[model samples]
Target chain A: MIAAVGLVLGIVAGLIYEPTVPTWLQPYLPIAVVAALDAVFGGMRALLDGIFDDKVFVVSFVANVVVAALVVYLGDQLGVGAQLSTGVVVVLGIRIFSNAAAIRRHLFSA
Target chain B: MSRLALGRLAAAARPRATRGQLVAAVLCAALGFGLAVQVRSNQVAGLSTLSQSDLVRILDDVSQRTARLQAEARDLEDTRAAVTGGASGSRAALQEARARTRTLGILAGTVPATGPGIEFTITDPKNHVHADVLLDALEELRDAGAEAVEISSVGGEQVRVVVSTHLVDAAGGIQVDGTLLHSPYHFLVIGDPRTLAAALDIPGGVLDVLHQEGATGMVAQQDSLTITSLRPAPRPQYARPAPASGR
Candidate 1:
């Protein structure tokens, strides 16, 4: 319940404030958001499994965003930024799908 | 079964796992914020939603369009310059041809002339004046730059004097180009009046020599005179225009 409240509050604040993302971060913000979504799904699956850890969840969230941005930055320097960014999204998307399936099974028990 | 389910639900709802729950709440908040911000920015900057390859394709299309339009504009400018230049060039040539025609028409004596000149009246009561004496007077006025000349008798018989005009001493009259006339003769001349009058009054000139023939010549300077006599322009049968040479 508290997490749901926090999520709603954050969305409302983001919509109202319209924070300006810096130019250097423009390319990475969407990727970072995708990685964060993957982390949330994984946390939900862990919670359903009765094995959610506070430290692990927080670390994974931060690490997922940072690693994704760094890979994209390296790809830009290597002149294959578009292809590499696609690879990152694909991997995070797979993870989010599997975790979501697991959460659905826990909730519906089917 | 209901009691066991109630006990398990109460345990799960207890605050024992509060630390992890708090962390989960914070992470969820961050996730939601990033999602909302990304969505908003995507709406604000429409191009940000496109992929890198898509943006490159768009840029290529725009640049190619711009280059083609520039070339088209240059072509139009060149055509406009050529059209205006040709129009002006032809206009000047037309004006020059018109002016040349006017000058040629005047010089060919196909048109009447008007200017200041002198009228000479010779009194020949006994008809002692011959064709040679009249010719000398005509020649003298011509030498004084006479532009146009005509001779008329006291009876109003007149002839336009041109380069081909011939004077003959006919019986009882002077026949000028087959037109016979008796004295007193009036020569209507068109030129500088002062010059023509002086040319006639010189010692031993037409006026002085007329006295020996028992004829008296009177000169009157006039401010303006109109010579209405005109001659037909001759067309040459044998003469042809020469071909242009580079030199």
Candidate 2:
């Protein structure tokens, strides 16, 4: 419940502020978002499984965003930014889907 | 995946608002903020999803369309020029045809002609000047580049002389083109005056023959004279323009 409130509050704050992202960071923002989504799903699954840890959850979320953005940045340097971003999105998407499936089964008993 | 042993032990007796939930809330907050920002940026740019190859293909298509449109414009311009210039082209053709008509009228002796030329007067008191002698004089004038000629009897009749004019002796005079001509017969000719006078004064020329016949011939140069004699345009009876030859 608190996590959902925080997510809503952050979205409202982002909408109100309408912050200007710098040009160099714009390319990796979407990839970071997808990675963060994957991390959230994973955290949700762990919580339902009764194995969630504060340090592990926080570290994984931060590490997911950082690593995803870093790989895209390196790809840009290597002149393969488009291909690398695609790869990152695909992997993150699969993880998010599987975690969401696990969470769905736990909550619905279906 | 193996459970985090210390985390599993800590969460064995789960509590509300645990530290893990607090951290999860912050991470979720960050995730939500990122999602909002990426969504806003996507709406603003709207082109980041397109690959470089796709953009290049679109550019190539637009360039080809522009080249085709330019060529079509040039073709339309040429067609307009040809259509609008039609009147001027016809006008030029009409002017050339009129000029040709005037030239033909002069050559056919159906129009009065004027230029520098000589006047030849023969006083034949005894009617010693015959048709053949007059004919010889006309031939000499033509050889000397006389462009127009008319034979006129003083205060009598004027007859325009052409290439096919007929001459014959008659009662005490000469009949030219069925018109009786008595002395003094005046010949008004259009040509180079100096050349015509030189041709007449050559040894064994017209003046010499007239001198031997006891008839006197006089030649005078004039700067400008108009032969007012105009011939009736001839209607060809047996001859017509050939099929393929320029006039």
Candidate 3:
């Protein structure tokens, strides 16, 4: 119960705390946002299994977080935040589809 | 009944685990641990990073991006040179070069500080380039292989330039909207001087017209030109026009 609360609060905090994304990367905001959600799903999947590979989970988690931050950072930096965000959204979309597939396979496949 | 239940419980305790379940278990544990760490780090780093000066980070990011852009611009310039020099009369290559040049030009116009290039001085008799004229000049220069262009007196009422508009002016001078500019009408255009000059001089061009009108326009091919951003003016948005009805 405590952990769940902490997770909720942490997410809320993250939402409240704005990242310093560049103007050029503004478009990627949705991408990062979506990617973040996908990352959480992926993270949860790993967490659900008792035998978890820290390496895989950590690496992907870091990549997802950093990339999200980077989309904003580089976007803000280049003044093409929107354009960069578009690119980020494209990448996030691919990740989302892949994650969704994994979820479907895991939950539904016999 | 108690003894039988005890025996079954003992047997169930030793039941074999499936590989799929085993893998899932491990993965889930790992994710739990990793998430714990991610949360911690995010809390620490996110707060710290946010608390830190964003402007400084922004400047650093800008500098790094500028370096990358400059390199890319140089690469494009070299490719263009090689293509032109091959003189294969390859329409495809020329077209590609032209297309890339225009794209780069538009990009450079958007981020004037990104590349190492030249400067241009466009003098307005009234101290401003007409909207149509400014856009024409910018497009021509880009087509001519200008990697970047900076106009003066941008970022104020005196100057305005967006993707749609051709002309921009400041209170006293003109700007292309990326950088605040001043006159003797300095236009910092970055690219190959000779080729760029020829591109501007194409038959029946804006440059020719400007020249015919005795406007002060000079293109200085430079080893390097610096483009920096000035404070942006508050952007304007359109509202519904009020209807005109007789009271």
- Count of residue pairs whose backbone atoms collide, per candidate: 0, 0, 50
Which pairs of residues collide in model 2?
A: none
Can you write out model 2's per-residue Cα lDDT over B1-247, one digit (the tens) per residue? Answer: 2334335434533445877777778778877887887788678775554445456778899999999999999999999999879978999999999998887877789988999999999999998999999999999999999999999888889999987899999997899999999999999999999999999999999999999999999999999999989998999999997888664
lDDT per residue (tens digit) for residues A27-102 in model 1: 7988999998898788777767777677888899999999999998898788788888999999999999999887
- If ranked by lDDT, best first, what sequence of candidates would result? 2, 1, 3
Q: Evaluate model 3 with DockQ and give the value.
A: 0.01
Query: Regarding lDDT, does 2 or 3 come out ahead?
Result: 2
Residue A2 of model 1: what lDDT? Answer: 65
How far out, in Å, is residue A96 in model 2? Answer: 25
lDDT of 1 by residue, B1-247 (tens): 2443334434444555487678777778877887898899888988866657669989999999999999999999999999999999999999999888765644565677777899899999878999999999999999998878889897678787887788999998789988898899999998899999999999999988889888899999999988776667879899987888874
What local distance difference test score does each model get?
Answer: 0.84, 0.86, 0.56
Provide the TM-score, chain A, model 3: 0.58
Residue B84 local lDDT, model 2: 76
Query: What's the TM-score, to 2 decimals, of chain B in model 2?
Result: 0.69
Taking chain B only, the TM-score of every model is 0.67, 0.69, 0.38
Tens digits of lDDT, candidate 2, A1-110? 67777899889877778787666677778898899888888877887788767688889999999999999888877878788989999999999999988877776655
Residue lDDT tens for model 3, A1-110: 22233345555554555344444433343444455566656654444333334356546655775777676676667776556666777777887777666545555542
Compose the digit string of candidate 3's lDDT tens values, residues B175-219: 444344554555566677777777766787767767766676776
